[model samples]
Target: MRSAVTGTAVILAVGALVTAAMTTATASASPPAGPAKADPPRPVLVDCTWHKNVRPADFILACGDGNSRLIGLHWSQWGPHGATATGVNMVNDCDPYCAAGRFHAYPVTVRLDGPKPWKKDPSVEHYTRMSLTYTGARPDAFKAVMIYPLWD
Candidate 1:
């Protein structure tokens, strides 16, 4: 009688352990509820160049590079009243191909020309120049987003 009781207890214990293990595994294996969302794309860097020149009655800021595959331009006119002008252009180079096998480099240049009174000398015009250099790796899985101040 004692042997029978021990055998039954062992069987019950084994069954319970097996059931618990199966339940835990099934819960874990099931997929999560929500749909998977992909991450946003990243930006890539190409060749670029810029310059600023002060001319009478206006300021000329120019930037460009033959090596860059993609090029963009922007400008703003600062005077008594705030006025702005902007433009973008994409150019593809033939050499030093992009990672995606595209023969294009991103290039950007800007030129701002306008009349503004110098802060120090009200009689003289002030010509201010500014430029930007972007450096980063291109994303493999996502498309790049190129943004410029003039885009807005």
Candidate 2:
């Protein structure tokens, strides 16, 4: 009898949680609230033409993935295999809409690795991938090194 009662209680608790989650999800179905958003441009490199002296230490890169750009890049090491750079990526909480002005910054170690030929332009080379490993607080975030490809 006690085991049966316990099972019933567990089932009721799970049902309640499921119901609450459903309610929350349904309530947020409306369009996100925030400032007006301009259509995101195609996901291309912020600037494919980057040089050592000309490129700024910090810049805005619109990677049309509807997230955020890599901010505050301070390169400490550079080589053929990869370039180690310290930077900040503002993880945007695009609750409803991507262009919503909700962004949070976190320190990240960037790796521009796997040099490859610029398929279209044979004269130049590009980093096949860019990896980010967060070195700061991770609330609702991950410690994984997420790799993103770079394009001309």
The top-ranked prediction according to TM-score is 2
- Any residue pairs clashing in model 1, and if so which? 69-91, 69-105, 70-105, 70-107, 71-107
Weakest 10 consecutive residues of candidate 2 by summed lDDT? 40-49
lDDT of each: 0.38, 0.65
Estimated TM-score per prediction? 0.22, 0.56
Query: Model 2: per-residue lDDT, tens digit, 1-152?
Result: 99999999999999999999999998799677888897532122235344322123664444456366777788886655667778887777776776665887878888776766556655555566778887866427565567777664
State each model's C-alpha RMSD to the native.
Answer: 20.2, 23.1
lDDT for each residue of candidate 1 in 31-147, tens digit (9 for 90 to 100): 877877865321111112222222212221213423232223343543432323333323333235633334323333333323355444455443332232333333233234343
Q: Deviation in angstroms for 15 in model 1?
A: 0.2
Worst 10 residues of 1 by lDDT: 41-50
The residue pairs in collision within model 2 are none
Off by over 4 Å in 1: 34-152
